[model samples]
Target: MNQLPKESIIKLQSHINKEVVIQFQGGRQVKGTLLSFDNQLNLVLDEVRELPSQRILGLVICRGALINSFAIDGMVEIENPYI
Candidate 1:
C-alpha cells in the first residue's frame, strides 16, 4: 500500500468525533463511534450507531470492539456524542 499523504492523515485524525461504517470479511457492515486507533491499524469503537435498516450484522458491541478493516472508514455522520 502506498503511504497516505500527511494532510489526509491530519484530516482523518481531526474528524475523530464521528461515526464510521465498518465492513467485515463476510459482507457484514456496521456503524459506530471511532473511539481510537493504534499504529498497527486496529480500531476501538464505542456506542455503535443505528445500522442501516437493510443490513443485519451477526454481532454488535456498544462499549467498543476491535475491528480490522481493509481501509480507513469513510466520512460518517453522528447526531450525538462528542469524540
Candidate 2:
C-alpha cells in the first residue's frame, strides 16, 4: 500500500473513538463509533447501525474503495456506561 498522506493520518487520528456516518455507493449508509483506520482508509467501527432500517450491527469493517463520502457524527448523545 502507498504511504498515507500526513493530513489523512491526522484526520483519522482525530476521529478515533468518535462517531461518524459513512455513506457508500448505491445509497447505503453506516453509522458507528470510529474504532480504527488504515492508510487505505478502511474503517473499523463499533456499535454500528445500518441506515434507513436502522439495524443494529455489532461491528463492521467498511472497504475504502466502496466508500463514497463520510460525515462526522453530529451532536447526538451516545449512552455508553463503559467509557
Candidate 3:
C-alpha cells in the first residue's frame, strides 16, 4: 500500500486533547475532547456529548466516513473539573 503524504493528513491530530464539534452526514453533531485520530480521520473522543439534547456519550470512536465536517469548539476551555 502507498503511504499517505505528510501534508495529505487532515490535520486533526494537532488538536488532540482539545474540545471539538463534529458534524455528521445526517445533520447530527457531537462535541467532545479530541483524544486521538488517524490518517483516515477516525476520531477517538472522551466526554462525548450529543447536541440539542446535550446527552452524554462518554468515550467514542467516530468513523471518518460519517463525518461531514468538524471544528474546534469555540474558545472555551474544556479542562476536566476534577483534575
Candidate 4:
C-alpha cells in the first residue's frame, strides 16, 4: 500500500490532547493530560495538576474571562516510578 493501513499510523487526534496550558479567563491555570474535548473547543483533562501548590484540580471553567495569556510547556520528559 502506498499509504498507511487502518491503524498502522499513530494519530495524535490534534484536538485537546495537543498539550496546552490554557489560561482560563478566570485568572486561573490548568495543567493536565487532555482527557477529552468538545465542539466548543472546551477541554476535559485528566491527571490534572495545578500550579501554586502542585495539587490536583477537578474540572474548571474554560471561558476566556480573566485570561491574560497562556502557554504550552511540552511533553513530559521525565519518568519517576516513585512519586
Whole-model lDDT per candidate: 0.52, 0.86, 0.86, 0.55
Candidate 4, residues 16-72, lDDT tens digits: the string is 555556556555666766656444345566666676566877655454334454455
- lDDT score at residue 76, model 1, on the 0-100 scale: 55
| Model 2 TM-score, 2 decimals | 0.75
What is the per-residue lDDT of model 1 for residues 1-83, given as tens digits with 9 covering 90 to 100?
Answer: 99964432423465465667766655555676666655544555565543466443433442213443423457455587764
lDDT of 2 at 52: 72
User: What TM-score would you give candidate 3 relative to the actual structure?
Assistant: 0.77
Ranking, TM-score, top scorer first: 3, 2, 4, 1
Which residue ranges in model 2 land beyond 4 Å of their true spot? 1-10, 74-83
Task: Put down candidate 2 lDDT per residue, 1-83, tens digits, no spaces.
Answer: 89955656337888899889988988898899999998889999999999878999979999998998878955356699897
Pairs that clash in candidate 4: 25-65, 25-66, 25-67, 26-66
- Note the clash tally of each candidate: 0, 0, 0, 4
RMSD of 3: 9.7
Query: CA RMSD for every model?
Result: 10.8, 9.8, 9.7, 10.9
- Candidate 3 lDDT for residue 82: 96
Candidate 4 segments exceeding 4 Å error: 1-12, 15-18, 58-70, 74-83
